[model samples]
Target: MALKSEQARVLRRRVLGGLIRNLLLFSGAFALACLAIETFMVPSIANWVADSTSSWRTLNSSEQFQQILTDQGLLDDANLFDLWVNEAVEGGYTNDAGTITEIQGEVNEMEDALAEYASMMADSPENAEAAAAHAKERAEKLGADVAVASGTNAAAIGDASTFIDDATALDAETDNARAVPLLPYQTILTAEAIPTDDASAAQAIAALRVSASLQELGLSLPEAQTFMPPETTVDAATRILVSAAVLGYDQPTLNDLLQSAFRQSQEQAYSAWLDLTSAEEARALGVSDENPVWQIQYGEDGVYRMRDVATYTFVKSFKLPLALLVFVAGWLAIILRALNRSLRYFDELSGAVGRLLADKDAPIELPADLSIARNELAVIRSQSLADERAAHAAEQRKNELVAYLAHDIRTPLTSVLGYLDLLRETTDLPRETLRKYANIAYSKAERLESLINEFFEITRYNLSAIPIERETVGVRLFCQQVAEAFFPEAAARNIRITVDAAGAGQFFIDPDKLARALGNVLRNAVAYADANSVIAIAARQDARTTTITVANRGREISDAHLETIFEKFYREDRARSSKKGGAGLGLAIAREIVVAHHGDIEAASERGVTVFTLRIPTQGEEIEGAAAAPRIPGATEGVQRPVEPVPPRTVRPASTRATSAPPSATARRGPSARPIPQRPVGERTQAPRQGTSPLNPRNARHGQVPARKTVRDNDATPRRRGLSR
Candidate 1:
């Protein structure tokens, strides 16, 4: 089954979608848990605790307390009211005493002012009545202000003069009152109260003196109230008794009586209040305690408090367990679902790999599902199958190579032995016959040698990297030498070979290695090129690269063969029996050499013409001690060699030309032969053939070729052969 493309895309989307969805789910779960804790669980717990505890001694029933819980939620609002109540209760009664003290102080100041004004009026009887009246009005106004501070009615100011007289008499009577011990009462009053401008100092002093007098008599609250003056109103007597109690004058006894009475009254009032607001009663009031709301706490001190104790305590008790349960359940479901989908695919892949490993010939079987195509296991399976196929093909090639080598070597060995045996057995044969046998033997031996060398060459290339012994060589001269060496062979085959070395430059190369590599290409060209056809050899150079091309008009190589033509043991002639085909190692060896020098070689064939191109770097890597070599003449220093002059070519048919001029520095063929242009060294030039000239006449007219000294070849070293693959 074929893999589905849409399925693969869908699988990717599903994977990413699953990841994102799971992340959101987990995040959402956590956020919900937090929200529940903050909004519901925490508040519920706080409300429950508040309802359960006593708020009568604290402030759970206060308006501020209820508002805090309603506004801030239960957890933050907890215990807030208790804090406020404690503060208020500690200072409440003492504040009242301070108010009284302030009012009395203001009244005393008014009396002193009035007394001073009256004395001034007495100095002048005519001004006496006016002064007295002014003083009285001033006194009345001051008394009214004092009355407001004391929490007394403004009507009390009507008797300001009389009140002043009584105050003075009281002050006189209290002169000896200071001698009495009242340290405990004073300390209690100071702690409870801080006198302020609003309080009546005169009233506070009177209350203090009364309390002191009562303590000296060791009277109870009732006994002190009874001793109050007859003219004193019930309100005045009650204030005296309360102040005495606050100042620690018979404090323990008075506190017990007051608490008992207060408790009795508060218990009745609170019971009635609670009944009115009970859950049953709340429904009638349109207030539902569907959640049983606040607990009622009534204290011994007659304080009533209520708190919410059900909602928070019940919620806090179960929120975490519920949240945890939900989280675990969700995660488990996700894990199980993921495993259900993935585990089977993984298991199947593992089994397939195991089978393949166990039996080398076993075919790999993978799921057709495109969802699994991008999985690691699937990739490994695919690669393993491909490697197995490649290994099988390679083994078949190796078997064919061994058989071909055996036959090729045997044929040459048999010929050489047979020729030598003929010479040995025919002693009476003619000299020419003897010579013929010897020559045959020698030729066979050479063939055998060439075959052996080919095997060695393959082994050498395969064994390790090929090292280059580099030297500076004139590229143009090198091409000339190669062409000259092949001239005799080409003449024998009725084929013409031409060399074009226009604008070729000096290059650093391993001369022997390069020669061998070039020989392989030339040998292939010579073997396959049609008889009487031109095989063109061209060499040129540019700034960085030196290019050499061997082109011939011959059988066109197929595109498939052209790609693998340089592969070891690969031959276009699949028969492996062609006499000229030497084990198909020649071009492969050439490629190895060129590649080792960090260069490239390629082959292309079109319209019965095959061309092999080699491009090696001109400024190749230098070996140690090779930098100081003398430069070639007519070769530019640190630059490409200039194009040499091209002598006119003599065109002739293939049959008419017996000898060719020691081919020109830039050679071409036929009537179209012209001076080849000088191009920058390392520049790539097209492959040369019958009709193509490197030079353009228009370019030559423009003086593209620079005038320079002609280079002459002076080295007369004899040419060596047997380098061709």
Candidate 2:
């Protein structure tokens, strides 16, 4: 299927456009779900999609982390380092800002604690007082702090209905510059000297400030912790416990320290496991439990050291991409199916074209989508069928013409036979009687011969009806000769004939066939011209064609008859007898020969003048109808022809049928298409009557001894030799 044809091009473009549109639409929808619409989801579906597929990675990482720990003899039931590190690192998420702040806080606290502990260990009285004053200042600061707000949900900030008016403001942000308060003046922070024996003394010094602050709020320690500043998790808790025990801590304080130490130990072990792989090792290895492309999976190597995304990467999911592929593939299949179905309409067209000549009456049908092509095909079929019906009608008319011609031949033949028999039987007949008998017999024989010739013309009206040989001819001479050929018959009726070939110099045409065509027209005109009426023959030429017209003055042919006058076997008056009526093929055959040169003929009658016009193209083309499949033994039955109420009633159709030349003086040189009013059938045809019918012996001008004579065919075809132009 070439894309050049209309149907193929239409379907191809449509299918391609559909596919492109579908792809673009699908892509847009996918992008909307991923970029625009997904943001409104509660969990942020990206997080869901991004995190949901992490289970396998998590398991793999946990195993790999454990393997390293086990290799280092650090993996034990009590430690469970992998779990510790996973939580501490917040599901292994990088925490660049949090890590910096955590390490800073630890450093600040260690500095203060060590300074106080060193002063107490110095055992100097002033150093101890200064330390006591410092502790008193810290307690006073703690006491001035606001009490912890009460609430179960941390987001509510201690009250379920707590309004966050500032947060709603567009420019809202944290107040990073908190004011550091000065200590309030105290009358006495030291009620007595510090006790040396009690293990609670150290704790008392450290805890009393926070405890006193809590008592001021009348809240328990845990409750006060909400308002208190947050502390980072301390590492090496066991060392802190050992040092505190050596400083004389009792069972209760020791128990608290032991518990804190136990939990911190687990965290410390995790920190140690991650520390096993240094920054160097981290960059080199492609581990099993890593991000896609062996990116860092767990906390740095195995330890829980917070880092940024630029350093540590995570795993990815393929689900969304896979789903997109399936979506596009399925749509592609649907597009193919739709396009495939459209091509089936062409199949319907093929079948419909094949059935154009079938003997069926049903209309060809197609899908609504193919309406344009369908309607056009329907028109073609209608024309073909109409031509078929007309052909049949033409065939029927041919048979009728044959029967009528036979009858006509019989009339003349019987007369001739009867006249001859009378002459043969009467031995002593009078000289004048014998002369009359001979004249009658000769006339009948002539009529019979004319009828036989007409029949022969009809038989030639088929696929190979006539062949043409084109040549240049003198238009003036041609028109003059054709007009002069009818002078005899024209004179017999006192009808004058004129030729107008002005500006019609030489023209290219088929001389013989074109002459015959012109002769037929002139003959018809002469036979029907009014007595003393003028028959004018005109020939002219333009750039492309040569035009000739023969006009006679007589009774008018009705518009109805004019339409069909050029069809096969069409008679103006069928009742006209052998002597006056034609088989009706003269004008029709004239038209055929003219059309063969790629031109046309037309007739018009108005007032009392009837005219027949012929046009022949300067550049001839083949007449397609002439060489068409031979008709069913095609005879121009209306021998001669009619347009069969066909040819759109526009003069005539281009057909392959020919016409028979009946013994028609009516076909002679006549403008008579309508019948003479109430005239007898065989009466001397008047008011457009036959003049000196070459068929009727009484009407023919026979020769005297010294007179030169002219003989002509029925249609005035110039068979005369040595004829002067």
Off by over 4 Å in 1: 1-21, 41-394, 425-427, 468-472, 576-578, 620-725
Q: How big is the positional error of residue 477 in model 2, measured in Å on the Cα after superposition?
A: 0.5
Alpha-carbon RMSD to native, per candidate: 23.8, 19.4
Total clashes, candidate 1? 32
Candidate maximizing lDDT: 1
Could you say which candidate leads in TM-score?
2
Provide TM-scores for the models.
Answer: 0.45, 0.50
TM-score of 1: 0.45
Q: Write the per-residue lDDT of candidate 1 for residues 1-725, one digit (tens) a residue.
A: 44366655655566547856886788697888788778877766665565464232222222332233234332132322223223323323233434554345553554454344334533543443344345445656664322211111111322355322333333343332212222222332333343334433433443333333343223344443332222334433344343443333453454454444334444554555556645644443243455555555665445555554455556557867987787778777776776665566567666776876787456656666533543544455555555455445545665676687778888889999998888888789987677667656655665675566556545544443344567899998887766665666567678787777777779988776677678778878877889888888887777777878787887876655654466555667766652565656667656655664566666666667766777777888522221112222354444422212111122243443333223432343212211111212111111112222232211222222222111111211111111112
Worst 10 residues of 1 by lDDT: 708-717
lDDT of 1: 0.50
